[model samples]
Target: MTNASLTDAQLARSIALEAGALLQAIRARGDASGKALGDIGDREANTLIVARLREARPDDFILSEEALDDQARCAASRVWIVDPLDGTREYAEGIDDWAVHIGLAIDGRPRIGSVAVPARGAVHTTDDVHLPLPAAANPPRMVVSRSRAPEIAKTVALAMGTPMIAMGSAGAKAMAVVDGRAEIYLHDGGQYEWDNCAPAAVALASGLHASRIDGSPLVYNCADPLLPDLLICRPELAETVLAAIARAR
Candidate 1:
């Protein structure tokens, strides 16, 4: 499709959906599991996404989780940040917390993006706000990594007197806030640009609040893709969550 015919948001969603399908197909074969499954899925999805992006937007730069980091993206004004198979371990283990991400960052900020949960057959994107965020649960719910819940997250949960919901994948946790499955997704554990760019764009589009844990705006396409922390939560909770994070730190 021509560039004028497809907006950046549309491209993001299409790429994420296609990548998700590729990952699901790989898993459906049941030939691999654990690390093997994750490795194959990551490589296959990355290849498919990179190839499609190169064909569709030859001029645009791309930064993918599974691909070699190219500092050249720093010189481009527009960069597509992607996570072909987010939560690879979850995906390999047949868990539903994995996701596919496609995001466009313009001027170092996520301008449009999509996050697809193939297992759930759901694709949340800046292009379409199809799901109304569910009403915040009583006392609110904070989502975190199942295996490595951050200490700050626990501190915030305790401060807010809310339950901490552990899940896999940065995209899944971020989308959980958008889907109303959880009211907060705060991560201080290490992460890269590809891990949260799409999710941040979708979250911002859905009217939720997304930013660094310190309340700074998320900037992408940097010399280093290692993003140390992120916060995606209901808008109403931004003040409270940020305050809690500060106190905990």
Candidate 2:
């Protein structure tokens, strides 16, 4: 599609949906396994998504989680930050937490984005979306990873005085906040840009707040490419979340 024909928001959703469909097909086959699963899926998804983005928006630079980091993207005013599959491990294990994330970072900030979780049959766009909340009426819940729930995160949950639920996938955890399944999603320790970009964008666009633990804004298309920390929460809990991070540290 021509740049003139597709707006940035539309393109972001299209890419995310396309990638999500591909991931669904892969998951259906049930072949994703071992080291090979991640390596193969990462390579294929990265190439496919990047090529499509480049073809659709030839003028804009692209920074992808699975692809090689290009220093030129740093200088580009607009770039596409993508993670074809944000939670490959979850996908490989037949878990439904995985999602396709596509974000358009303009001037180093994610201005628009989309995330599609095929397993959940849900697509979150920049506009007209509401977060899902738990049955309990309260301040909101916090969701962490089942396998990677660290003490630091638990401490944060306690400090915030919010209930914690363990889930899989970074995108899924963030979506919990977006859909009202939870109020806060914070993780520290080994996470890359692709893992959080699309979800972060969608959360921000939907009027939720996503940032680092310190509450600073998140900047994409950096040289390092590895985004090791994140804090996704509702606006009302921003101060408490930041304080929880400080206490945990």
Candidate 3:
């Protein structure tokens, strides 16, 4: 229960798992539905995560989707960028792909992180490198937003002759690549730091290449906190995917 006894990776995983578990409990109760369910999940999970982080790392800064932005985090060296209850809509609808994210950005780099898909009972973290990721499918598979697949993603998939699979949440799409359910996660739509930081950290540690779609490094803890797009994919496919993104754009 003490921060001194827990490594950053361990802390990230534990926090994410805890928040995911809380989310599961709330959903199981079924007192709310639609936006109400999402609101309750977001509020309760954020409260738990923020309180835990403050207690464990009092000096560290926090950036959470459900909490008010603290612009001061832009100046801090260690910032916990998190999505307390990612895929709120999916979660509201009882979808299995929604997740909880806990990420640490040290010196504007994703240093430690975890993403827990509670419904799927899977936790991917920077602490674990030996996860049995399935082999990449033939021609590769792409994971995208179920409601709005980016046109660039379509172009890339067409260029590679792969099938596109619709999914919910940025975390879910990124984890799909991390767990080997898919080979590519290209998001050109707008997103905030909380949306991708934790997922990026876990993906990078998993040996997948994670970066801005243009292949630039993903710098975090910025003043605006709006990261427009990112690409997470198999290492072997990073170059090809970046190139395709360039051509498509």
Candidate 4:
């Protein structure tokens, strides 16, 4: 589609879905785990997404995990930051929790985004926004990294008296909040712009609270994209989660 015909949200969703399909096809070839599989997927998906965004919105700055860092984006008002393959480890290990991320930050704020879970045949985006999520079941459920559940996340969960759900990928965990599968997704270990921009956009669109663990707004398209922490959760739980995080810190 032409640039004039597609809105930023639509472009984000389309590119993410297309790249996810490409990754799924590549993975269907056979069992190629570890670095080899991860490399192929990351390279191919990044190429597909970058080519499509460049063709569609050549004027917009683009930042991607698989691409070289370009400081020029910091000066541009609109930047598309993406993770061609979030959860590469899970993907390479033949897990279904990996995802493709496409996000557009306008004036350094996440404005539009989409997350594609190819294995699940689902794509969550800011275009078709959902109302506030219902409260999660009793005790509440917290999503955390399967391989490395950060101590801070554990501490928050304990403080809230919630149970933790092991998940793979930043996108997957964040989307879980959007899907109502979990009440909260808190990460403090570390992350970059490409890792959470799209997920944060989607979460915000879904009427959830998306911000830094300290309850600050998430800013993107920075010269240095090393965003260290994120918190996405239902509004009702935001106070408790942030409080727990603050107390733990």
**Candidate 1, run of 10 with poorest lDDT:** 1-10
Arranged by TM-score with the best first, the candidates are 4, 3, 1, 2
How many clashes would you count in candidate 2? Answer: 6
Q: For model 2, which pairs clash?
A: 131-178, 131-179, 132-179, 132-180, 133-180, 141-183
77 Cα displacement, candidate 3 (Å): 0.4
lDDT of 4 by residue, 112-226 (tens): 9999999888899998858656768778899999999999999888887899999999999999889889999999857999999999999988889999999999999888899
Stretches off by above 4 angstroms in model 3 are 1-4, 131-134
Q: Comparing 1 and 2 by TM-score, which wins?
A: 1
Distance from true location, Cα of 93 in model 4, Å: 0.9
Segments of candidate 4 deviating more than 4 angstroms? 1-4
TM-scores for all predictions:
0.96, 0.90, 0.96, 0.97
Best by the lDDT measure: 4
Compose the digit string of candidate 1's lDDT tens values, residues 1-249. 663368788877888888899999999999988999999999999999998888888899999988887788899999999999989889988899999999999999998999999999999989683566667888999999998999999988998898998899999999888888899999996899999999999999999999999999999999989898999989888998999999999
Clashing residue pairs for model 1 = none
lDDT by residue (tens digit), candidate 3, 120-196: 98998898856666777889999999988989999999998979999998998998898788999999877999999
Deviating ranges (above 4 Å) for candidate 1:
1-4, 130-133
Ranked by lDDT, the better of candidates 2 and 4 is 4
